[model samples]
Target: MPAYFQGLAIGLAYVAPIGMQNLFVINTALTQPRRRALLTALIVIFFDITLALFCFFGIGTVVERFALLQLLLLLCGGLIVTRIGVGLIQEEPTLDQSVEVDLPLKDVAMKACVVTWFNPQAILDGTFIFGGFRAGGVAAGESLQLILGSSSASFLWFFGITLVISLFRAHIGTKLLKAINTVCGAVLIYYGMGLFLDGVGRVQQMLSSLF
Candidate 1:
């Protein structure tokens, strides 16, 4: 397979999992108007692509070299992710028949930024995955193609999911929406706690090395 196609497959696999970015986009689609959901997806796509580039270039190497940076990211990202999950769990779901209050573009953008940039797991995973690809003996043109293909995957997946959810919005009742929120929130909290624990473990290892 061409490098572009190879990257496309990897990208799809990477983002297919139920992560913060997907949850945010899914919730937006379930609650907000189609236009707003689509816009949110675009904002998320921008962040995702930039993040992928960062990881592919050298951020992973930088983070790995700095234990302090890694610790800080894990703790901070855990707190932020857990907080977002709590917010989702506490949110009252509005029925599809009711008037939907749309979040401002700025708010949507901020949320997208948080889910993508503040997510430590995504960062580490992308960093290692993309970084490995970079470490491979691929030509410069192939590298560019890989990046483009990965970015295109983000665009397609987010937009595609948003449209699908929007089309089925009418059938999703308030209860179902609430359930979705609760489930997504719980999963996030679990993931966040795992990150925090990982940070704690890292701290212990660092301290042991010091002694």
Candidate 2:
């Protein structure tokens, strides 16, 4: 029981920050229909939970042990994230409520996956945090309970935010939405550039070591 609560708290702390996942969800809620927004939230939750599981189970160790893997992830994730940001910046927000601007379900899922799985920061952070907990004398049953609690947090936070945004979307003007998108897009591009630079530095170090 204590473990479960601990996991719940950690999970909220892990996810409550303004990041790619939250930005994507918020944008969907603002632009898409209520059903589509909720579905996007669900897709994000699925990816988040699976990512948590992967980190808790030992993927973190694998990433740590393999410099090549880390380099590839950084480079690929940066490119993809940067492209997504460019798209958001270019997108023109509409005031028309009658027009369906909803993306296809597959597109939603793909974006969710990229924002969750391709995020090296999220992966590395989750790996350290959850992996640390797993290494810290937790019993198997307790670990399971902890994971369940974390999953619950993802469910609660995404759905709650989506519903709230959907309700207030009427009050949100197109200008405000466009501003939000621009800001979020800039942030993402900055983050992506950092990742790409880090990847480049890693490559340089590897080459130096071999020489």
Candidate 3:
């Protein structure tokens, strides 16, 4: 019970952060139709569980142990996220009150996977946050409980956000959509730049320690 509650709280705390993933989900919900957005949310949930499971099972330790790999992930992820952010700024959502533009199912799935899996922060969350909790053993069957609690948090948050956006979508005009794009883009770019800088700093620190 304690393990389950602990996992739930930690999971919520991680998802609550205004990071690239949350913003992407919200933006998708606002711009895309309910069906497509729901699909995207499911995909996001899948990746979240996959990552958490990987970390909880101890595979994430292998990846996180190498500082060089972490640095590389940060660099690559940062560049991709920043590029995406810039592109989002230029692309307008072609949605109106009566009309809904639904992205192809495959396209939505691919985007959801990329945005959820490739972010460096997401990697850190799995490796550091979930991995740390996983190290603290739960009761025999409690491991499953913890995983359920964490998975539930992901499902609830994504679906909840999607539902809210879907309900209010008609009231949300195009201008507001554009504004969301702009803000989300800027925030993603900032996160990317920060990731890049953090990688550079980590490398520098490693070098200094060696010298």
Candidate with top TM-score is 1
Instruction: Give one digit per residue, the lDDT tens place, for model 3 in 1-211.
Output: 4777777877787787877778878888888778878888888888888878887888678886777788898888988888888988988875664776767778877777778788888878877788887676556678888888888888888899999988888887789889989988998888888888888888889899999
Models 1 onward score TM values of: 0.96, 0.95, 0.91
Give residue 118's error in model 3 in angstroms: 0.7
By summed lDDT, the worst window of 10 consecutive residues in model 1 runs over 93-102
* lDDT digits (tens) for residues 102-209 of candidate 2: 787898899999999998888888988898888787887798889988999999999999999999989989899899999999999998888988999999998999
Over 4 Å off, model 2 = none
Single out the weakest 10-residue window by summed lDDT for candidate 2. 93-102
Pairs that collide, model 2: none
lDDT of 2 at 70: 90
lDDT of 1 by residue, 105-145 (tens): 89889989999999998999898889887887679789888
Query: Candidate 2 or 3, higher TM-score?
Result: 2
Query: RMSD, each candidate, Å?
Result: 1.2, 1.3, 1.9
